[model samples]
Target: MQSELIHDSDFGRYLEDFKEGMVIRHWPGKTITESDNNLFSLLTMNHHPVHLDQHYASEATHGQVLVVGTLVFSLAVGLTVREISGRAIANLNYSEVLHHSPVFIGDTIYAESQILSVRSSRSKPDRGVIKVKTTVTNQKGEKVLSFLREVLIPKKN
Candidate 1:
């Protein structure tokens, strides 16, 4: 007996569906909150006074608690997953990660990604490698983070 394969249509796009220069705007931006910063910091073992202690942050340059960088990076990448890498077999690499501005509590983060390149895998014929550049902006239209990521996506037969 032979088994059939199934692909979830709602998951994400296949490699063959992606095109160079394609741009995707991720929906439903995320709002940074005090609890978000606190929990993310504590859970990650990031004991940064600026991200946890409001009292200390008040005296700091930003004059308030600053959100952790990893938190921002995590959310930024997460926002692009559905449209970019949700169906990926593996994340090949992440590069050129830059945090351009600070993310504070009450800030809503929105993300958009542009396809950079695509290539069929030499060792694998059933999948292709895709590269994309994602930029994360705040509600105020300020760029907060940007990065490049490469993923391997299965080709539909």
Candidate 2:
């Protein structure tokens, strides 16, 4: 008897399904809250006043607590996981991260990604690398963050 393998349709895309110009918008926007920012800051040991101190922030440029930049980046990456890297073999690189605007508590964030490049591995024929640029935007449609990352995905054989 022979056994067959099953692939879940809702999981990440394979290398063969990717195109250079493909774009994907992630669902279920996340709302940043005071607790979210504070917890993330505390967990990451990023005790920055601007992100945790409302009083101090009131005197700063934004005049409010700014969400930690790393937290925003983490959320963006997490938002894309289901569609982009859910089944990825590995994450290869991340670069060109830019913070375009400040994020504060109560700001809702959404993310979208565009495929930049795809190439099969030279040594490993069953896997390939996909480079994508992901953009994060706020409720007002203002771009808050953007970054480029490369992930290794398996090819559907």
Listed in order, each prediction's TM-score against the native is: 0.92, 0.93
Q: Give the best candidate by TM-score.
A: 2
Model 1 spans with C-alpha error above 4 angstroms: 1-9
Q: Show the lowest summed lDDT stretch of 10 residues, model 2.
A: 1-10
Error of 2 at 33 (Å): 1.1
Quality of model 2 by C-alpha lDDT: 0.91
- The alpha-carbon lDDT assigned to residue 156 of candidate 1 equals 88
Root-mean-square deviation (CA) per prediction: 7.0, 6.5
**lDDT of the candidates, in the order given:** 0.87, 0.91
- Model 2 residue runs over 4 Å out of place are 1-9
| Cα-lDDT of candidate 1 | 0.87
Clash counts for all predictions: 0, 0
